[model samples]
Every structure is written in structure tokens, then in C-alpha cells.
Target: MDLLSIKDPSFLKKLSIKDLELLSKDIRKFLIENLSITGGHIGPNLGVVELTIALHRCFNSPKDKILWDVGHQSYVHKILTGRASHFSTLRKYKGLCGFPKRGESEHDVWETGHSSTSLSAAMGMAIARDLKKEKSFIVPVIGDGALTGGMALEALNHIGHEKKDMIVVLNDNEMSIAPNVGALHNVLGRLRTAGKYQWAKDELEMLLKRIPAVGGRVAATAERIKDSLKYLLVSGIFFEELGFTYLGPVDGHNLENLIENLNYAKKTEGPVLLHVITKKGKGYKPAESDKVGTWHGTGPYKIETGVIIKPENTAPAWSSLVSETVRRLAREDERIVAITPAMPVGSKLEGFASEFPDRMYDVGIAEQHAATVAAGLATQHMKPFLAIYSTFLQRAYDQVVHDICRQNLNVFIGIDRAGLVGADGETHQGVFDIAFLRHIPNIVLMMPKDENEGQHMVYTAIKYDDGPIAMRFPRGNGYGVPMDKELKEIPIGTWEILREGEDAAILTFGTTIPMAMEAASELEALGYSVRVINARFIKPLDEEMLTQLFEEKIPVLTIEEAVLHGGFGSSILEFAHSHQYFETVIDCLGIPDQFIEHGGVNELLCDIGLTSEKVVEKVLTLTREKQKRV
Candidate 1:
């Protein structure tokens, strides 16, 4: 049943286009059944089945590297490359990853999670191949929507000038995670409509060919005429002028056409751009109609109906809270413009978009451009809230530092998925933002305890027009805390002490606050009094609270769901060193130096000794050791 594990590689080579078509059907059906049982990317994988089959048929994998951009559409590639049996365990614990992992298979040349990095990577591989005098085709399969990224454009410029023998396959489905945004999407829309003009030109060529000796001369002249006509139909001066030999508006669903075009590109010389048009969800009717990107990444769903099976009694998700809160704020303040790099559905910004369409921007996986654009908007005094995942925000770190923080721009960066995102694993963990952002000057970074506090933090970020601020919030459901009706503007750089104890002070932020409370309760049972402080603002450091805790001779403990290096506790250590107060022992609790693997959040937390029971044990051990010394 699994084509991947078929021992005879010659079987794939012998398969006709008709056989491949049938195989595509089998792959689609298999993907549907497996993904329906175990939640994963259904729409993109189903759409790319034929395209992947055609590519592997034409190109030799492990020799000719086919780099998949973002790796979301790599399920078909995986299914074809000795991983079909693993599809049953997709996105589960100790199962096949949703994205392409290099260690998983030899065919997967690169690991990708975030968008728009493929072009640069492809270029690097191409240049490396050239340097080594190795004959391998470097093909980067990028989505039409991924072209909107500034980095992709930059890479295009370099690759165009280098004139390297690389293939850039533009898989144009007219959608990213959501329907694409900006001028690029508009340009693609016109280019997609140029099918009629292309047909006319093809007919004109056949007419010119009938002129015998003059046919060859007339065909060349007719090609120029077609080029002129192409300009008339839709202007793609973007790709054509970039020195890439533009080919196709080929049907990606058609195996014959895909194989032919791929073979054509393989035989061709330097820098080919093969544009293939595809449907997001080719076979599935329910997913095909989903324009909101709900089918992009999913949990277990009903195959008969397109209904997502949600567990009852789940709290309101943090993403929904942010989107709704932003919408409410925007209703009052017209200057509040919401921005996401590409994710509208993932970030739950559809509610805000529906209410204020013009004010919302889905920048199409261009985080750097979004940051700089927000900076530009801030110069004009517009309140631009750049909502992006913490991991994705890393892509635009330089832009944030140079364009935003340096200018002290009033951009509110609403960082979603701020903690451990389970299942997606190390590539997607949102644990590095605090460590990175804390070092940056003139930027205020804040975190919320729950959904209610997160809403208030949003209110705070929008109202504060002095400088750039980022509010980091975790993934999944909130702590069932009721949201406040009125927005409260808390003072900047302030923290609140929830409980009082002189023996030990527990400083924690965001989702870890509840864990700190639990740990403190356990410590109290062990006859050790513990103090709990909600360290709200990470950047500002709550200096007054720090000074008070230090003066009280209490042993300080910092807990955050971020990296231990250059993070919350590191700041405390830095403060202590500066003030010459090293006597008070401060222990940092967080993700270790090594990369954490995929699992449930709770499982990972306990494994890393961040659980309340572990914390309680550690505290008791430390206290007893201190007592013995006394």
C-alpha cells in the first residue's frame, strides 16, 4: 500500500502518467484517512500530491536537492520518499513531524518551519554545489504567496545576478496561510488571468510555423510579439526583469503537464522559474471552499463533514482573546491598525479583519517588511500593532532593533505563541523571545498572567505611544479567568506581589505564574514561607521590587518558560553583580541549553524539572542546605 517502501526504485520510473494519476489518487485518499485520524496539514498536502509525484519522477532525490519552502506542503514528498507508513503517526508524540526534518529522511535536504527562508537556502546550496564542482540541480519550491517576502525578493536579486543553474518553482495556489496580501498578490492575480493571452500567442506561433523557411524567423519575431502581448495582459516585470527565464502557468494537478514542465526545466540551462498553478484542496470539497485557512493546520476532524472535533469545556484561546481585544480597541481608536506576517486565521485576526478590513494587514510571511512598515506607520503617529508568533518574530530581529527600537517607534508587537508550542517541536518553540528582546535597548517587553491580564496588556500597549512595546502571550487556552469589561492602563515597568514570605521570593511571568503559585503552596506545606511576585514587565525588570527582595535577605528564584541563557534570571544576576549583592542566591528555572523535543506542554515541562513538585523538592533541598550551613 505504501509506495515509499517499494524496494524496486525502477517501479516508479516504469510508471506511466496514467499510473502516476492513479497513484496520486491513492496518496490523496491515504493522506485524508491518516490526517482525519491524526491531525495535521490536510489541504496543502492533498493539493501537492501530483506535483510532488511529478517532481520525484523527473528529479533524482538525495542528488538533485528539491528544497520545500516552509515545509508545510512536504507531506506528499514524504509519502513518496520512504515515509508513507509513518503518515499514520503524523504530528503525534514520537511520530512523523508535520514539517520536513533533515534527520527524518535523506530526501529532505533542508528543515524549514517559518516561511520565505527557502530562496536564500536554495541559493546557498546552489553556490556550494558550484564551488564543489558537483552536478546537482538545486530546486526551491516556493509558494506564490511566499514571494511577497522582502528576503525572497533579495535572494531573487542575488540569484538572478549569479545566473546559477537553479530552478525556482513558483507553486501559485493564490493563497498563503490566508489569501495573500499587498501588491505582489495583486500582480499574481493578473498573471494568473494571462492564460487567455498565452493561448492566443500559442495559436499565433502555430500560424507563423506554417510559413516554411520564414517560419523559424517568424516564430522568433512572434515570440517578441507574445512578450509585448504578455505585458499587455499582466505585467510581471518583477520575475522577468530579475533575469530568471520564466516558464509556465502549468496545471500542477495534471501529472503529464507537471512532469513535462519539470523535465523541460531539468534540460534547460540557467536560472529557470517554473510557475505552476494548483488548488489548495484539490480533491476534498469541504477544504477547497475554506478561504479562511482553517484547513491549513488542523486537529482531528470528521471526514464526512468538515467539522473540527473540539473538546468541550476548553477555555478561550489566547489568540482569540488578542484578536477580539484588538477589535474592541480599534472600534474606539481609529489609529489602531492590526498586522500579521502571514497568519490571520492562526493569529485569530479574522474577527478584527471583519470589523475593520482596511485597518488590518496580512503581510504574507514577510516579518521584516511588517516590522519596518510598522516603523514607517509609527513615524506618522499611527498605532500599528504588529501581531506575530514569537518564533516568526526572530526573522525580523534586525529590523526591530534597527528600524523600530533605535527610533523609539510606537509599534505594539503582539507576540502570539510566546511559550512552548507542543508537537511542532524545537523549530517552533517560542522560548527565545525574552532572551533576545531583553538585550535590546529602548524597547519595553511585557507578559500577561492570563487572558484577562493579556487583554489589559493590549489596552496598555495601544495607549502607550511613547516607544515600542511587545506583549508576549502563550499558545492554547487561557486559565479560565474572566475578562474585564473596562480596559485598565497599568503603569509601565511595574510588578505586583501576590503573596508575602520573607524566606524566599519567587519571581515569575506569564503562564508560569500559576505554576509559581502551586510551587509556593507546596513549599509552604514543607514549612518554608515563600513570596510570589508577578514579574509583568521583563524589559523594565521591576527594579523597586528587586531592590526590596534583595534588602529583605530572601533567596530569590526566577522562573520563566523561556531559555535560561540571557533570560529573566540572567537579568537578575546582572543586577546583583552591578550592585555588589551576590550573597542572595538566585536560581533560574527554564528550558535547558539543549533543544527540547516534541511532546505535550505538561510532559515537556515536567521532563525539564519545571513542574511544581520538582520546584518544591528543589526549594526544600536548598533550604535544608542553607539551614545546615547556619
Candidate 2:
């Protein structure tokens, strides 16, 4: 039980394969117990326990590189590599990282969080080793779903063609957040079936070769016949044709089989593909049965019932509202189609998928392909709604610019999780879309004040056959506003003033509108009487109202949850300079030029001075500065 007291891979290396299997069970139990309290990635870590054990036993890590793609499954790797004692502090602030941290241990050769990047990083490490003439094996453990990403495929093509000395361990878990999709998933299925038959036929041919007096040339012909049989039976010559040696569809759970196969691959030359099948939640009952999208990544849950215990409220989440409304609209409209880059469950598109199964497409971890495909669908005059997280959308910027915007097609981009997503940290925050998407030409961007406005915006986007449009909404629920059946479209490139005052103005968009309101109310109590305007449309300026505000000679304060540079605040300043309203004071409040760390959403906001209290302080400071100038 005292895993750290024992030596690491040295001790693991001494154990028999059966003992290692027992240790795998212990690791799973330990992960379940500790992660129940810490709320780390329990399901993924549990699933990869046996695989991690087999990997360490066979490969000499810290010498032979092992890179884990998407890194959430690295918990077992960390525990095995002498951090078992620190398991209690996993995902805690400054305690231990949820993903693989390069600084945490030398054994973790590469750090990763975003999916589909392991192969590329592995290739870099492999090339370095080769240049040094070091014979260390480079193995990248990539999941079946991660292979769907464009970057992973590109790396695969390059590595295969270049004939690099690397081994790709394809962990086919059949899921990635949601189930895997696209052509790669189909190819892996064929490879698994081919591997099952190929190994059997090879054994039969070896037996025939043992038959003496079958002439030397005949034996050579038989060997060629067997080789040809392999090519005929296996349709997945995709990797082989690309130049990499294909070697698997191994039993990932079976330690002996995995060890034998991995040992063989290690001795082989050039890039090799080892296909290994695994279950997402191998030992856990509740997680194993969670096909409806509950166990991929979970919060704190009861180990017995697997019931999630987060603070629950019945208010409709923004994802559900958007999906439900879209499904309702698509009931009559046949041209409407829904798409996500492998996030039907996370984006709450389950309703749409069920109702319009033929119309919905889950592209599987490929954001670039999703955008371009949506563009192609739009070209056919079919209204394609591309549902994606704001952060993930950053991955497909080129597609949005070249494929979608350049053509000026009718594509509705539903940007969900459009602000600070807590716990998952900097890599997962959806805070930069307004800053990035606003500047792109032929792109109309909008964010809703509440769920009602979100519905209206969805309707507006589908009806306007002009060009590409995106509507961003925050992660959680709305402001408890009532819904309506009849939808109405708000005018594009415009803003609605929520509250009016003469002393100063507070301009904002999306969820920050509530924060701005709270700050304005607090300022009013202090006799400041600040104006609060909801600038829903981030791109096109509401020039008519802004000009009148400038004429009033009142100071303007812009607030957003995005970066300050090249954001809404910057646009207001540019407008002020163009109109020569230098006499009117202008200020901006937003996230500073630094990556925010992981914490509770409210805690993070207060720490970064984005809270209502911070906003009030900013307003008072600006007012005093203006008076000092006078």
C-alpha cells in the first residue's frame, strides 16, 4: 500500500506480470478514493492504469521518452513515477498539476493539455535523439479520438514519410470527451479487425514453411503468398503505404500481451503504429455505463452511487437553451444542420442530435475541418450552425478567415463557454473570441444579454443570408429571465443602453453586463450616477449613441472579459481619436496581459480585479484623475 516507500520502475520491473496487474487494481482504487475529494480526472486516469504500468515496465522512461496526448490520463503515470504520496493534492492550486507538468518530473518528457499534439511533440524529441545518435525509443501514446485532429494527422503523415525512429501507441478507447468520429475512427476499426486475422494467418504460414522438401523457391513463393495475403486481408495499409511499419491492435488490458507487443516494436526500426484497444472507465461501474456523457471528466462524486455533488440549481444552462431553441427552429427548416468538433455532450447538442440525427455532425476533435465543412455546407445554401467553445475556435482561425469569411457564406457559429471557464485553467478559458473574431472582416459578432436575447440572436443569424455570424454566450445559466415562443431579431451593429446618467458611461457586452450593472449601482450609491450601456454587438460600433455620449462631455469606461489590447475598449479609444473628442476622458477595464491561474470563477475574478468592487474602484480613480487634469 505504501507505494512510495517501494522503489519506482525498479520495483515494478521486479514484479511478475500478475503482480503488476494486482498493482493496477490498487492504483485504480487509490485514484477513486483520492480523486473523489480532489475532483481530478478520475475516469481517464482509471482507464489508463494498466497501460501505464505496462509502459513503465517495458520502456526505460526518462531515457526512453513517453509522451501522453491530452495529458489528462497522466495521473497514473505520475503516481507510478514516484509522486504517489502527492496524489491527495492533485489539481489543487500549486500542489500538483491536473495535466503532465515538465517541471513536476523528468519522467514526464512532454507537457500537454490540448488534444492531438502528442505526435508532433514526439517527432521533435525523436529527431533530437537521432541527431545525438542516441538509441532511445520515442513513444507517443495517442488516443483514438485525438487522432481525428488535423495536427495529429499532419504529424502522422510527416513522421511516416520521413521514416523517423519513433513508435506511436494508438490507445483506442473509442471516445474523446464524446465518442470518436471522422475517417480516422473508421480506419482504426478496420485495422483492429485486420490485426485479429493477420496474426492467425502468419502462424499458419510458418507451419507450412516447416514442411521440408517444399522446394526452396516454392518456400520463397509461399512466403510471398503469405505477405500478399496480409495486404489483401488488411485494408488499413494507410499507415504502411505512408512508410511506417504497422504493428498492432493489441490487448491493452492484458499485461503479457502488451509487454510482448511493445518489446517487439521497441526492437523494430522506423516509425511504427501499435493499435491497442481500451475502455474509457475500465474498472468503475458507474463510469463504464456513462455513455450519455457524464463520466468523461467529472466533478466531485460519491464513489458508491457516482452521483455528482456540485451546487445544483434548476435555472436553464445557456448550452441547453441554445440547443433546445435551435432544435425547435430546425423542426420546420430542413436546411438547418448542427455541427461540433467532437462535443455533442459538452455543448448540449444531444437534443438536436436526437431530433435531427441526419442533420447533426460530430466531427471529432477537428476544429479546422468542422469550420471548413460548415463553410462548404453554407455554400450549398444550407444554414450550418457550428457549435464550438471559444477557446477551441482559436485552433481554426485560418479556416474562419480563408474558408468561411473570404467566401462570405451564411454560417452561424455558436460560441459557447465564451468567458473564463473555471478549474480547467488558462488552456481552457474561452476569453479571447471577441478580441480575435471582432477584427476579422466579413464576420458579424454578437453576444446576448440573457437567454431571450440569445434565442433571438440565433433566429437572426439563420434568417440573415448575408455572411458568417457568431453569437457568444457564457458557460453557466442565464439571469433567470423568462423565455418567449415568438422570436424577434435585434438590429446588427447596434447597442441598447440599459441605464442612463450624465457623469460617466460604462460600456460592456455579454455576461459582464451584469457585473457592469452591479458596479454602476454601487457607484450611484456613492453619488457617481454612472451610465450603463449594453454593447451587445462587439464588432460594428453603435456610433449614434456613442457620439451623443461624447457630446455630453462625460467620461467613458469600457468593460469586457477579454484581453484589453485589440478589444472593445480599444475600438472606443480609436473612435474617440478619429472624432477628435480628446477633451472627453476614456478608460478601459479588463484582464491584464498575463495568463490567469486555476481557481473558482468568482475567486479568479476578484484576484484579477474584475469584480464589481474592482470596477467601482476603477470608476472612482478615473473620476479623480479627470478632476486633477482640470
Per-model C-alpha lDDT, please?
0.85, 0.85
TM-score for each prediction? Answer: 0.94, 0.94
Q: Which residue runs does candidate 1 get wrong by more than 4 Å?
A: 7-10, 196-237
| Model 2 lDDT tens row, 1-630 | 667654467677888988998998888888888877878777677778888898998888889899999688998888888898887666655567777878788988887778999999998988888889887988899998898898998999999878998889989888888877778788888887776643565667777778788846557798577667668778777777677767777888899888888887887789988888888888989887777657878778899988877866667889988888889889989999999998999899998998899999998898999999999999899999999999899999999999999999989999999888877777777878888887889999888899988899988888878899999998888877888879988888889889987778899988888899998999999999898998998878889988999988788899988888888899999999999998888889888888765667787787788889888988888788778777
- RMSD to true structure for each model, in Å: 2.5, 2.3
RMSD of model 1, in Å? 2.5
Output the worst ten-in-a-row residue range by lDDT, candidate 1.
Answer: 1-10
Q: Compared with the true structure, what per-residue lDDT tens digits does model 1 show for residues 1-630?
A: 556575322356779878888988888888788888787888888778888888888888879898999588998888778778777777666778888889888888988887777999999999899999999898899997788888788999999998889989999988888888788888777777666343465566688789878988877787586677667654564676787767777888988888877887887777988888999988988789989788987888999998987767467899998888889989899999988888988899888998899998887878888899999999999999898999999999999999999999999998999989987888888999998999998999999988888889989999997899999999988878776788999899999999888778889989898888998998888788999999999989889878878877667788989999999989999999998776777787888997776667888897888888867766666666556656
